[model samples]
Target: MYFDIAYYFRVLRHVWSLKQWPGKRGMLFRLLLVVPLVSAFHALCFLLDYVFFPRLWRQTVERPVFIIGHARSGTTLAHRLLAADGNQFSYFLYWELFFPSLLQKKLIRALGRLDALLGSPCLTRLQRWDDKTFGPTRHIHHMSLWNAEEDQFVMRAAFVTQQWALDVPMMDKIDLFHLDQMSDKKRRRWLHHYRECVKRQLLLNGGERTHLSKNPLMCGWVAALQETFPDARFVVMLRNPNECIPSTLRLLELSWKGRGWQPEQYRESLRVMTEISFESIRHPREVLAGHDQAVFVDYRKLVAEPRDTVHEVYAALGLTVSPSFDAYLRAQQDRERNHQSRFTYNIDDYAVSVDDIEGELSELFDEYQWPRLSRRSDLVKSVGP
Candidate 1:
């Protein structure tokens, strides 16, 4: 319900000033028409929720677990693993994030049930659309509307999401990453909206279940989140910067290209994102150093021995894995063994260099014992699950 009207107009003005391109018309349409219409509908639905679901006001977000890391650091795998314990955790499936209001979600669920009675034609079509829509980048990042996804999309309705950069290439203009540095008024407003979103989700899923969230951008939000949710628990995933940085840049590059943005249009934003990536690698550890409720996960170990790694995480978080969840973990072990990523990126494709990464993150490289490359050719390695 709290829209960032100022930021929305700023992006609109910037987009209006850009020269013509293939995606320009679509961007204009989304910014001028689609966003306002959808936001208005969501805002109305949000208001109606109180009338229809008054118990939503009493919902609480207690001891929510957040998974934070740099992109391509296995946060998804970890989130899905924990979310498998369905009775213990409640999360926002990709489609659910778009419909934040409890009323909207319930209505959709009802419609889904009705559709099922009618041979599930609507559900079947949605599945085909999901496959086609997410097919291109599935290798880079597996995504489906039904999968538990990043909760940051909950802020999309408020026009306060980092995902806008995927279509607009305005990372330099919009800074959703650094919540701690924001003015008190703006930061509190953003986090307050986010908390309300979480509360609605908790209400929809069942108030007794723990809320689970995974977002790479949350790396910059550790301090703000701690301040907001004093009882929050965190899982910080760490991977070699050499791998995550390039992989992240490559993803943005491909996304921007597909959206009709030329390299010249997004180069500066990409550079800005590179700087953020370094901080993403360093910030969470720095913030959560002595925090008792926080746990660090090594990417290599997470892929190599997921079950043991998750068990360690559960122990650290004071959670007991149920027998069924433990069996699910054991089953995932075999799947992990056969997993492979067809996605690969070269560090040299971007402006960053090996020396730059090593120099900027010498301490992380030393601490994590991540291997350094002797030749540029070694930089073109496959990114893993």
Candidate 2:
């Protein structure tokens, strides 16, 4: 059934008020509409929850797994591979953002299946809920759908609570980090709920011994993750920082998008990412040293010899190599492959010498001995820029 009459009227009022606002075009539209809509949505959820079926709200966590690395670090690919075990179920698209005590959970899952068959499920430019490869999952929020760990829900909490203008710049800033000035107690509350949201996925899935997941944002929060689940294993994917820097710049560029950015934000994000990615790798290595729980994999190795690499990971995790898993691997074998992002960035694009950008990652690149494009250029020049 459609919502109550008051709900319909409220929505109409929201839409009509939206048409009147002069500042609705830019950040203003989101600032105004997102607040009340999200607020109403959240309230409607709690109101219907428990009082209704209460079962969907009470499911226990089934299994817990995680995929952790910086953005664009092949974490998405890993999510696909690990989650491919057909025996182990994952939350589908619609259940992502949808919170309906019970009516919606059953309703949404049914619709998601139908939507997948009827046509495409691509919801936002960022991702799709449909059955296509080469895409990340987002948009739909349901209790049933497994989600890559995202701050969007948490950040949405802040948005609804404070209406802290989620314009393009703020999003870029939030992308970098969100709990900048909150007190320790408040920050802990944010983190607690964040993990709770993740734990809920394990509840929705079969709650197996192994809970598989991946999130690019988790890199910065490695310590927090270790604090929460000491047994949690992290697989950090590494690429040459010189290549990583440009790829990170591109990812940020994708987010800033239409808004004009201060040249400094791009440079700063690059510089910050360079530091954080390496720190994310090193600090966890140092902290989790004796634990032997965290593993680092090379992206090139993953794409080239996926079977061997995946086998290595499974072996390390102590998973009994099942024949069913082998079939799963074959199915995923020739799937959407990696697109090496290094070639996407030309030396001329940044208006800075490769050496200059390479300088930020000097410590990491040198330690890992991944050659610089500058060094490669010199090698080419000696032989035949």
Q: What is the TM-score of each candidate against the true structure?
A: 0.98, 0.68
Could you say which candidate leads in lDDT?
1
Q: What are the per-residue Cα lDDT tens digits for candidate 2 across 36-59?
A: 676577556545644564453555
> How many steric clashes between backbone atoms does each model show?
0, 22
- Per-candidate Cα lDDT values, in order, are 0.91, 0.50
TM-score of candidate 2 against the unseen true structure: 0.68
lDDT over C-alpha atoms for residue 372 of model 2: 71
Cα lDDT tens digits, model 1, 31-135, are 999999999999999999888988887888899999999999999989999999999999999999989888989999999999999999999999999999998
True lDDT of residue 14, candidate 2: 41
